[model samples]
Target: MSFLLNEIAPDDPMWNKRGALYAPSGEGPTVWAADDIYTVKAASAQTKGNIGFIEATVPAGGGPVPHAHTDEYETFYVL
Candidate 1:
């Protein structure tokens, strides 16, 4: 099932205090730009700039431009 941007929760309390982060399916701060949807499950601030977990939904033939991360690792999981 697909979820609208506003339908997901904007924030999670567990992220504020450096505690465990847990967001059920279809929950997170979501944004839309460049013809794609980006839902952030774990923000940089929540991870002390160490990591960020985001779920991206891209339409057919749509995706980010080729880019490289200079200071961090990036991974993708196709569902």
Candidate 2:
């Protein structure tokens, strides 16, 4: 897992901390492609390239094409 912060400015304090709280009751950018529901919750810019996250609902017996995420850590959770 390559967690590269290539764009991090040295003058920026790494000790700075921030957070957000949400109930997860909102819709984000969506597209109707490949018969799946994709909801982008957090984007790279929103997290300052620290992370990205999305929610996808694919129908049974259907799935997206193989994909890869370059240069970062990823966490996938199902509820």
Q: What is each predicted model's overall lDDT from 0 to 1?
A: 0.69, 0.54
Error of 1 at 4 (Å): 19
- Which segments of model 1 are wrong by more than 4 Å? 1-18
- Scored by lDDT, the top model is 1
- Candidate 1 local lDDT, 8-42, one digit each (tens): 22254544434566755897788887899888887
- Separately for all candidates shown, the number of backbone clashes (residues 3 or more apart, or on different chains) is 0, 0
TM-scores for candidates 1 onward, in order: 0.71, 0.58
lDDT (0-100) at residue 17 of candidate 1? 39
In terms of TM-score, how similar is model 2 to the real structure?
Answer: 0.58
